[model samples]
Each structure stands twice: as C-alpha cells, then as structure tokens.
Target: MNTILVTGGTGYVGSWIVKGLLDKAYTVRLTVRDKDNTAKFENLRQIALTTKGKLEIWEADLLEEGSFDDAALGCDAILHVASPFTLRFKDAQRDLLDPAIKGTRNVLYAASKSGTVKKVILTSSVAAIHGDTKDMTEQGLTEFNEEQFNQSSSLTHQPYSFSKVEAEKEAWRIAQAQDEWKLVVINPSFVMGPSLSSLSNSESLNFMKDILSGKYAMGAPAIMFGFVDVRDVAKAHILALENENSQGRHLLAERTIDVLEYAQLIEKAFPQKFKLPKKHAAKFLLLMVGWMFKLSSQFIKRNVGYPLRLNASKSREALGLDYIPLEQTVKDMVTQMLDDKLI
Candidate 1:
C-alpha cells in the first residue's frame, strides 16, 4: 500500500489526490495521456521535488487496452480517477461511455494482473447514484445514498451521467470476479474548490466562470445540486485508501443548495464584486430557452427545479470527514479563479 498508481493525475480532482499522497510521502505513479506535455504536470513535479513522496509520470491512454499495464507494475494500490465529464459531446457512446467504461475495465484489469495490488479506489460521481433530481421523488426517497443506482440516464439523456453509471458498474463487476484486490468507490457530488492547476477544463470551473462572467446575469436555472469541496473530496479518497474499514461505496457531500442559494452565498462573500444573478428563471422559460444554455428541455424538466439531497453519514462516520462550509468553499474557489484571472 505504499506505491500507488493514480490515473488522471492531471485532472482537477486527481491532482488534489496526488498532492495529498505526495504530501504524505507515498510513492505515487501518475498516468497521463501524454507524457511530453511537461507543463500539464509541472506544478506536481515541483511539489514532488520538495516533498518526500516519489512521483513518476507514465503515458497511458484510456481508450487503448493494456495501456496501464506498465504503470501498474509493482504498485500496491490503484486510484482510478480519470473520466470524461463534459456535457457537450457529439457521440455519447464513443465520447463518453467507451472511454469511461472501457477505461475502468482496463485499469482494473491491470490491477488484477499486478500481483502486488491489493486495493483499488475508483472515483465515481453522484451522477452514478442518481441521474436526475426528479428521481428522488419518483424513487420514493427523500435523500440519496450509496445503495441507489442511476436508472434514468441513457445514451440520449444526460449522457455524462450514463457514462459514470456504466463505468462504475463495470468496475464492480471486475472487482467481484477477482479475489486478490478490494474495490472502494468514492461517489462525490458537484465538487468545487481551488484546483492545484489553473489549466483545468472541468465543468465545475466552467460553471463558476459562467456565473461570474455574466453568462447567467439575467437568471440561472434554480437547480438543486449537492455540493462538496474539491479538497475534501480528495482527502476522502486518501482516507478511503488508508482506512481498511472503508469498503463498498461512500457518499461524499457537504450540503445541498439550489443555484440561487449558491449565487447568494457568492454575493454575501464578495458584495457587488460581479454581475450576479438576481433571481432564478422560471422553469417553463428554461424548458423553452435552455437550448441556448446547452440544457435540453428534458434536462430542464427533470433537474431544473428539483431539490437534491444526500445522506453523507458514512463519510463522516467511516472516514471521519468534517465538511468545509459552503460559504468558504464558494469564497475560496472564486478567489482562486479571480487570482488566476480565469473568470
């Protein structure tokens, strides 16, 4: 459990996990799609130079089979955190499902092949647990938990959610078939915080940018979303790796808030600093004009006006997680983006 292989080490969430592991003096091997792009991981490399942890960069592709075999050699654990998370895609199966599902299968296959690997942590999103906020009412549950599986998303509807569900399911299938290694899933809600690198194209960053840059100045959809700090999510992953009792799935979220509440929090933190949305647009208006915002009518109907709730007792009880307040999360993230001139 000393040497760990981390996929998607350059990503927003993965970078934090890698930094946490590096800070703890663990031998962390990070897999990237391209090793030649030194700037993508220059910050991590500099951190590794200062920290006790050893960092190695290996080039691997999610779409290619046997790509992770070399990187997984002699590794005690694998942290599979790489997956596509964009909303706009031309082909759902090729752009989302294949990379996510096949990527999980390939990474786990490497772990099974590696005799040294005894544990694996997969970064699955809350999207996998439930597709739409409307699902909360339809399923007869007030809050979401680890036991629920997303059943509403498909190739045409919320394809990103569909990809995560299929990917996690594939991981579980492989984990069940093998007896050598154990699988732990970390399902996090809308993660937001100051990313270690400013070059991330994560939807979380884009969402904030859209709000601050006046893309939603007129109004934003009053969508309820579960929020969690990116740093907290990263810590949960490392905690899951270190704690033997951490098994199965753990839901990681701080609290639930609507988009208007989020804007209010931002306004409270920095009064009149940016052109913020004054109110939530009507759901009916969103259903008609959501296409301009890249939201389909079905998306608006299913998620725009629903309340999203999640029970994170397992994370607190099992991982000893004390969530960061939503106010601080919003402030820190906005400050970082502003300092970096990203928005």
Candidate 2:
C-alpha cells in the first residue's frame, strides 16, 4: 500500500479526507503542530482502527521551514488541505493570507524534493474563482468554472478570497516549475455536512450555529453561495489523487442558494431547534451591517442580492461525482451540531 501524507488531518475537511483515504487502505502520515496532542487526533486513530489502515502523526508547522520534509519523505502522495480559514480575523494578511500562501509553497516545495511523491491534491475554495457575484456576469461568465479566477478581490477588499486566489496561484507556479509531482486542485464551495470529529469550529458550522441560535433572527442577507457536502469534497480529493486523468482544477459545489434559502432548509429539516429566517434582509440593510461587522463592504455591495452560479460539471463528469442534495447536506450538518451540543 502506498503511504500518503495528509496535512491538517484533524480539521473539518481534512479529517474526512483522512477517513476516505484510510477506507481505501492507504497508509497515512498525518502532519500536525503538536504530535503529543492526542486529544486532537485520537478520533482519527479510532477511525483508522475500524478501516484497517495505519496512521502516523508527525509534527510540522507551516511557518517553520523544513518542518514537513520528514513527513513528506517516503510518501507516495500528499494532500495539502491545511490552511487558515476564519471569518473573524484581526489581521487579514497575518491571519489568513500569510499562512495560506506560505503553507502551500512549503508543501509543494517539500513534495518537489520528495522523489517518491507522484501527486499532490490541494484543497482550494470557490473564493479563488470569483471574488463576488457581480464579477461572474461582468466577466461574461454565465457560470464560474475552473478556467476563471478571482480578479476583483484584494487584501484590502475581500481578504479571504484574495488569500485563496494567491495561494492557488502560488501552487500553480510551484508545480509548473517542477516535474516530480502533478498538482490537482479541488476548489470546493461552502462545504457542509457531518464532521468526522465532535468538535465544531468550521466556518460552515459556525454559519449553521448562528442561524439555529437566532443570530440571524431578524432576517438573512440575500447573498448567495455554492454549497457542497463535506463527504463529496473528501471523495473528490481521493478520486483526484488516484485518477491519472485528474489534473488541474476541479470546482466542487453542488448548487447555489441564498442565505435565507439555506436557513429555510435547516428549519425544514430540524424545525424544533432551528428557527428559519422569516424575512429576507434588504440589500441596503446588509450594507449597513457589513460596515459595522467589518465584512468586506464590497462583498455586500456586489453580492447582497445577486445569484452566484458555479459550474461544477468538470468535477462531476471527470471524477464521476454525484452530489448529495442541499437538503440532505443541511440536515446532516444540523444533526452533527445537535449531537455535539453546539446548537
């Protein structure tokens, strides 16, 4: 069996990828900041036991050079899924951009030096494709695809989107300069589903919690986002790693829905606990809140009431992916939140 190095194997999406890889009987080496933090990775070990695959934890830090070299050695493939993802950030450059861009470079550089590594699957986001909904139509794109990239985002504008764009670009640059490994990027949208671990800190989970907890009690912004199941995202990563023809970027969203529509899905699935937004907040109202909340004011101005479309045909046809329904995805997420007592 080939050994695969999985970065951020204890995270929301990364954990599922580790489980999927283990189910396929791959010897997995998981990288983390602290190898002694058994509580953080114990669940992964439990899952590995059921799958009959081996799990090895290695200490690696994104900021520290040469930290991942030992982990990358002897691995057949690498799944670079570790990146800082947070909505609330004190410094966008320090908190989001630096880690994303630098971490990606470090992983690819290590993979480049590893003679045994053949492929690398990167977990990117739809934020890299188009910064705002308005850019979709402005670019003459009816639906966003892997060929398109975010051009309107900046460190001062939409910092999270900008981070993803820069990181993926860096990955592409590094891959083009090397011949040792092939780079496959999975650009997933807002991923939602049951997490492998009981802990809930993912941005997707936070959004669901806020909705169920009445944070959006008055109304939800009309902003739209593409949604996909976390399981599907993991499966895409696995398929991209194994399939010979799977190269370049794959957009991994099932469909697009507004925030209110998402809230309604959760409320319909779990009526007793989740309170669905009754009204849709006007674009102007969201604009005011965006200013107060320090959200990219440009995001409110561009995406407040627009429909954001993502063309996931490449991932579906190439990887043979059949996306789970948004209703099912939302329900599974709510179920996990309830099981963990987060909601």
Candidate 3:
C-alpha cells in the first residue's frame, strides 16, 4: 500500500513498523492520543525527514468511538498496533479491557467504513493464544500454534492477557461480518529490542529494567515465556500486508527461556557485573511472598516454574522472518537503556 494508517505509531513495536514503512517510501498517517506532544513522536519525524516516505500526525483516542475515522480514511491499509500492555491497574475493565476491546472495535470500524482500506493487520499477542505457561501441557500440546485461543485468563487473573484475547476476538468478529477488508493478526511474544523513542514506556523495557536494577537480584520467579525482537515483529506486520496469500494469525517468537536463563543471556552479552538473578526463586517462596511483587497467587501458581513454548513456523515460512537471537536482543536493549540512563 502506498498510504497507510498506523495507530500507536509512536509506541515501541509500532515505531519500528512506522520506520520500516517509511524506509519503503510509504506515506504513513500516524494516529496518536495527542498530536500536540511533538516530543513523543520527534524521533519518528526525524526519521521521516531522511526517507522518501511522508509522515502525518493525527490526534485520536483509543477509548473514543470514531476517533480513528479521519486518519483511516483514504488509507490503503491500516495497522492496528495500539494497545495497553501494563500489568498494574486499579480497575481491570477501565485500565486494560476497555481500551483494548473498544480500540480494536473502533479501528476496524473505521477501516470498514473508510472504503479504501483493503488490508488490516491487528497487533495481537501470544498472551491471546495461551493465558499461562502451564496451558501448554494442560492442553496436551507440545507448543502453542495459531489455532489456539487463551481460555484460562480472567478479569482477576492475568487481566492483560484477558484484554488481548477479547480484543483479538473483537477484531475477528468485525472482520468476519464484512469482506471488503481482510484481517491479519500478528501474535508476537515478549517483544524486546532498542526502541526508536527512548522515552517509550513499554512493559518489555520495564521488565529489563527490573532485572538490571537489582529488583530481581535476590531471585527471579521461575517464569518461562517466549521472546521476540521488536524489529522482527514489525517486519511480520509489513510482510502480512505485502503478501496477499498471508491469512489467519501468525505467531512471532524466537525462542522460549526462563527468568534465570534470560539473566544468563544478559551476562553472556555484557560480561560485566550487574545484579542479574543468579537463580530461580523457589515456587513456594514466591507463592508466599508474591503479593509483595504485585503478583497474584493465581498468577504465580499457574505461570511460575512452567515452561512456555510456541510454534512460530508460520512466521518463518510465510513471512520469511529470520528471528533475532535473544542474546543480541538483550545486548542491544541493555545498551540502549544504558545510553538513555534508564537502567
């Protein structure tokens, strides 16, 4: 597509997609919550100046209906990448679910009404596939694939995952009712890499900061999860848009590793003394004290000490994505955080 509408274009994963689209000379209409906040999108604007692509900033709110109508109109394609990833929330429905489900509805509605948008790529998450690590064995599957939908997440447990699942479902419901626009879902695991905007406050970056800042030095919960590079995730979105044959959901994950193994990767990349967790915290210990870390007992019981695995063959074969190694991903992210004084 020559002209595209990208929601959350200034976000962590969305920024990378915007960069790739600009590099390919596509006119990108970026929708933000506030177009007046130039600093939030200055990095993207600077990149736009050097590329052949045109960048247009528009103000829109995810919670408001029809907010994306003006920005999405006349766009050849739409990349719905804006969604909250925070785990901390006072109200699950208001903080996470509303923005996610409503945002998906609004974006897809805009695309459907635009009459020009033929392709829509929704940025879902692996959290939508399986709620917790234990779901793998419980479901009698070796690894999670495109066919699965998370069944364990609820309003009180892993609310973030619940929001993603509901949002993705809403996208599918909207996409099915109409044939004018085809929907492609990109379900990426924990996205990690250097962000284009240093001021970006993503949960992925916060997870890294927690590790390097000694919050988990004593011991990290033995939580295993999938990891993927932000760049790779962005590439998947573009590939989905470019390849007409691409259909259904594409799971984008490089590999699976536990908290302790992640620390080891960091140590291997840095080789410098940082308060990296040397070992996994005992499950019982975590169960007793998990509340101190804002971890629900149900979350700790279901996720801790369980291995998370996924089958990303579709992303590789269909999207032709060669995933980045976790070591390099960790190195680049740590280096950027250091430069930004975030860690």
Candidate no. 1 TM-score: 0.99
| Per-model TM-score on C-alpha atoms | 0.99, 0.97, 0.98
Q: How many residue pairs collide in each prediction?
A: 0, 0, 0
Worst 10 residues of 3 by lDDT: 270-279
lDDT tens digits by residue: candidate 2, 172-245: 99999989999999999999999978764888887777788787778888889899999999999998988899
Q: Check candidate 1 and list the clashing pairs.
A: none
Q: What is the lDDT of residue 264 in candidate 3?
A: 93
**For model 1, how does the per-residue alpha-carbon lDDT over 126-242 read when each residue is reduced to its tens digit?**
999999999999999989999999999999999999999999999999999989999999999999989889899999999998888888888978889989999999999999999
Give the per-residue lDDT of model 3 (tens digit) for 234-288. 9999999999898999998899888889999999988765988888899899889
Quote the lDDT for 44 in model 1: 97
Weakest lDDT window of 10 consecutive positions for candidate 2: 290-299
RMSD of each: 0.8, 1.3, 0.9
Off by over 4 Å in 3: none
In candidate 3, how many Å is residue 320 off? 0.6
Ranking by lDDT: 1, 3, 2
Stretches of model 2 off by over 4 angstroms after superposition = 291-296
